[model samples]
Target: MIRVLVVDDDYHVAHAHALSVGRMEGFVVVGEAHTAVEAERLVAEASPDLLLLDMYLPDVTGLDLVRRLAAAGRVVPDFLLVTAARDIDSVRAAMQLGAFYYLVKPFSVAALREQLESYRMWAERLQGTPERGRHVDQDVVDSLYSLRGAPVRRTTVVRTLQPTMARVLEIVTAAPEPISAAEVAEVLGASRPTAQRYLATLVKKRLLDLELTYGSTGRPEHRYLPRRS
Candidate 1:
């Protein structure tokens, strides 16, 4: 089974994530922690395979907890960041840490399950490799890198990114905070409509995430964020 440790400052939200993981197939909630101190204790006791980590914690940030663990030469599990923080720096840091996935907050159970399924497949592949010399071949390495839980029907992978698509991705990934199409247009010297088209495409490609902020008067504004690799 894929053991999971759910960590969030909010008790209710942490319990909700743990319950959701418990209901899934072949996954178990080893423990839930509302603070980094509790999380470190549970990591030693439970030894979970994955962490549904929140960026904001009462003691220290989730990212810092991971860093501290590594610095102390402690065992660290695969991380799946589940947080509301959309800053580019956070995303870059998570990627550098080699997180399996980064899930944005206010997400649905179905969305979470989709990523879990992909993770399960990837983990199974790693666990199932032949033991002769205990080394994976180039094909296995390629498969590991290419598995992003993308749709099974997506086969025509683009080797080179289109100029506009590349620019939109760059702008969002470098942004200090979640930005809107208007901001993107201003940065690219393009029209709002044109910016929206590119942002929508990036979201569809899973290269960026779209968040909605609702207002009392009008429609919810769509904000774009960089998607973690």
Candidate 2:
């Protein structure tokens, strides 16, 4: 399971977010922190695989904590910023400071799951596998750096959606029933519209089958299932 730490000054938010992440498959919440100082201590001791951080803390900025970790030669886990603040400047700074993704407040659990899965895939690739491509080169391994070590994007929507889309193709193809966008959103913590957009892309790619389902109230809901060769 992917070990995670949720850090926030607010007690409720910290626990709630941790619980939300724990509900996802192949994930476990290893710790929670209500202050930057405590967070640093816990991260060092627990050695989490992922850290969900809040921007504002009782003591210092989250970015400062990350910087401190790097300076102290501690293990730098992949970071996902979960904050209410949407300041462009702060967002840019955090990304530049090497946050993997920044999740805005009120995001769905699906978004969180998507990001976690992305991290998992990235980690697995780095851990190496026997069946890896024979032609794989340094650049292929380098691209995986963007997954944990480098900060390429700010918004969780973009950071999470791309990997989630790839996984959705897998899920839909394996599911026995047609999956609706709402189901996809539920699994990934994304908006239904966002899920639908990705689903549409897969359909365009001929990787999914799109159909319309009628609700009991006679409403039409679009559904997608995997297309088999």
Q: TM-score: which candidate is best?
A: 1
lDDT of 1 by residue, 90-142 (tens): 99999899787788888898778777767776787677678768777899788
Clash list (residue pairs), candidate 1: none
Q: Report residue 157 deviation for candidate 2 (angstroms).
A: 18
TM-score of 1: 0.64
In candidate 1, stretches whose alpha carbon ends up further than 4 angstroms from where it belongs are 148-229
- Cα-based lDDT for every prediction: 0.84, 0.79
Candidate 1 has its poorest 10 consecutive residues by lDDT at 151-160
Q: Once superposed on the true structure, which residue ranges of model 2 sit more than 4 Å away at CA? A: 129-229
Would you list the clashing residue pairs of candidate 2? 109-189, 110-188, 110-189, 111-188, 111-189
RMSD of 1: 14.2
